[model samples]
Target chain A: MQKEENKIQAVIQINDLKKSFGTNEVLRNFNLQLNEGENIVVLGKSGSGKSVLIKCIIGLIKPDSGSIKVFGEEVTDLSHDNLDKMRVKVGFLFQSNALYDSMTVRENLEFPLRRHWVQKGKENVNDLIIEALKNVGLAETIDMMPSELSGGMRKRIALARTLILKPKIILYDEPTSGLDPITGKEISRLMLDIQKKYNTSSIIISHDMNCVKITANRIILLIDGTCYASGTYDELKKSSDSKIKQFFD
Target chain B: MKSTILKDFLSETGDLTRFTMSFFREAFRPRYEFSEFLKQCYVIGNKTLPLVGITGFIMGLVITIQSHPSLKAFGAESWLPSVVSVSLVREIIPVITALICAGKIGSSIGAELGSMKVTEQIDAMEVSGTNPFKYLVVTRVFAATLILPILVVLSDAISLYGAYLGINLKQVVSFDLFTNQIFEKLTFSDVLPSIIKSYFFGFCIGIIGCFKGFYTINGTQGVGRSANSAVVTATFVVFIIDLMAAQIADIFQIT
Candidate 1:
């Protein structure tokens, strides 16, 4: 009964999802569930379909078959407008940060607010931008452009932009791919702080074991177009299976 | 191999048609992007004036100087102003201005959007609950369509002035006589069709550039390809449209 209740509390659920580009099958019969306030790390190799999985969840790439349910709503069934509304609740942080290069950091953060038609007084909007930047330790960088920021700073600004909406769920793709060890660890710790502060669920795609250790409450290992194994960072590290052992070693 | 090329061509045509239809459908919806539209007009209209003006002036002067000797041989030197004015108003100025814009504006839009696409900025906009198509494409296309006619009108007037100067170099003709000769020869038939066709030219440039840029792939290299193809395709479309416009005017006995 407790397990069944846990399943009901899932913020995101995917089952038997299949997606392919031409003959190159990226995901086949993939399944996963993310419950409320939990950070699930999707660990995989470079071409192991981690990004594809995130794209499918956000409806950027449609699955060939199967279902994706967000808060008990079928994602595939929603119209364009409804899908856009759903995007408001699901924030996605791209690997490249994808900040509008023409705009300042403040404008980039305000984009989601204006986009979703969240009406607020000018003072309130400024407060929201400042609060988001402060959360990412970037309150000083608001007037700067994305080009002027360092890689780590750009990533933080992107996170602040994503957090500005206070999304119920955040999907991060390769959050620590290009950063140095110290910067990567900082980002991972920041991820934890945000999760604690907002109680938001997240599915983070990464190959960095340190990031997985820091941010993951649970980890899903994607290999050969399927979820090969899943457990806590310690649980997976202790597995006797050769494929699972390779990651820990 | 030929078949594959044909298939690709057909696919692109279909996609362009669908893109154009979507632009029309979303353009009339509520919450129109008025400020962005104004910004685009300012950029598209105001920025191109210097280039268009220079090109129009040169076109008028050269056509008048080159054709003067021929008209003089036929003892029709007085016909020089009317001939140059009619040609400039009906075809040369609008076509040249559009081709210049194709090179300038089309490539710029393509590169800008292509870079945005490769960097995932367009996807980010969409995922942020914003309408990227309505915000980016519609405003640009609308600006191009509305602004090109005004540009052509301005270019025609400048070119006529250049022709007046060209005539003065050869023989003494008053500014009033030259102006009278131009207005007398240039009719509504000559003026309206040229203006009408320029709007289509602008639409083609804006839409083709957006389409190429929006669908960019293969990363940075794709950005270069999109920008290059946008100018080439836009310039080609200008010629095709001009040909069709000329034919339609001929059929209607307007030219």
Candidate 2:
């Protein structure tokens, strides 16, 4: 009964996930839990398997042995169509923005809706596009191509595309990477606002201490293919452990 | 080292065969991407007409000029229309057009898809509940297979016109007489085999290009490698198909 209650509260639960590529073991016995309406930041150094963990969560990479349950359903056991259905409720923002270069901002926003056959009137789609752009503060660049946009503007457009689906959970891969300090802070604040407005859960993978400090409700330190430590930013910063102190220092 | 190369080749062949089967499976499933398919047809078919037409015209004119001297030596120059027509319709136009498309269309598809893969756009499509394979591969393959035959037909007509112009360049022969000579020698056997082989060529180009691009790795440099390999592999496959097609046509006495 208690386990059932925990499952009901958690939006995503991963246990003992293991993955390797050709003798290089990237993830081993990793575990994490994301509760509803919470922001969990995963902090790790370069090549520390943070990206692998995110990919496994999104079903982009198959784990060697483990269980990843999203909303009480096992992701590893789902078929292709079922996985696609699950992804409709979950949005992923790539580290490189991953905006379709061939498409304009409006078309990029319309893609997920068309793919999932989300039934909306033409006017409704227009309204949604406008509203999503408005949220990201780039409502004027609707017809512009991704190549035409600056790095920060491209990131905003990508976020708008993710928001058009109105997903219940969002996964951000290095949301503030490759940006100036001011832009990174602005994106971090925008992320916080979106979280409060939608009441959506999120898992952000990043090594940016400023992003982690600004956006993380809780931080998980991933080391040696597993969760080494997890705590609030302040709590982790106060720790005396050398590994955790290295990050805070 | 030789054995290792052979093993890798076999493995790649197996992977490609499995990819082909998966394409067929997804192609028949629900929610067909008809709009994207039509868009691809427009891009691959309609856009290629100018290049194919000019190449065909030049090929026909050159063949007539080159073959005329030999026929004149034997005093069989009057048979120029018949010989050039048969060769153009039966073999030259189809093979040349396929090779050209293998370089143009195949490389373009490879580079576009390879860049998409590198940038994680394909993964984005998948996560957004879009069938990237259907939207990307199936449409392109279907378009190529269906459009190449049409392109070949257009080329054949234009080349015959060029042949008429070429014959007129030497001595006066009415367009009516020249066309009549070609039609008299032309049979369904010659045309059908050639048209049939073009479909295989199109399929080979589409599939090879998709395979290379879809499985690309190592980032931007890999995109260049994919584009290069796609053209090279598709060109080689075109020749292999043409050779097999010739043997089959001969055994059936279609040529």
For each candidate in turn, the TM-score is 0.97, 0.98
What is the TM-score, restricted to chain A, for candidate 2? 0.97
Candidate 1 wrong stretches, greater than 4 Å: A116-118
In model 2, which runs have C-alpha deviations exceeding 4 angstroms? A1-5, A116-118
Q: What is the lDDT of residue A113 in candidate 2?
A: 88
The true-versus-predicted C-alpha distance at residue A174 of model 2, in Å, is 0.8
Task: Compose the digit string of candidate 1's lDDT tens values, residues A96-187.
Answer: 99999988998899888885445686788899999999999989998999999999999999999999988999999989989999999999
The most accurate candidate by DockQ is: 2
lDDT tens digits, residue span A1-249, model 2: 998888788999999999999898888899999999999999888988888888888899999999999988899999998998889889999999999999999999999889644578778898999999999999999999999999999999999999898999999999999999899999999999999999999999988888899999999999889899999999999999999999999
Query: Which tens-of-lDDT digit does each residue in B1-255 have in candidate 1?
Result: 999999999999999999999999999996688988999999988889999999999999999999999999999999999999999999999999999999988998899899999999998988888789998899998998888889999999999889988898899999999988888988999999999999999999999999999999999999999999999999999999999998999999997
Clash pairs, model 2 backbone: none
State residue B169's C-alpha deviation in candidate 1, in Å: 1.9
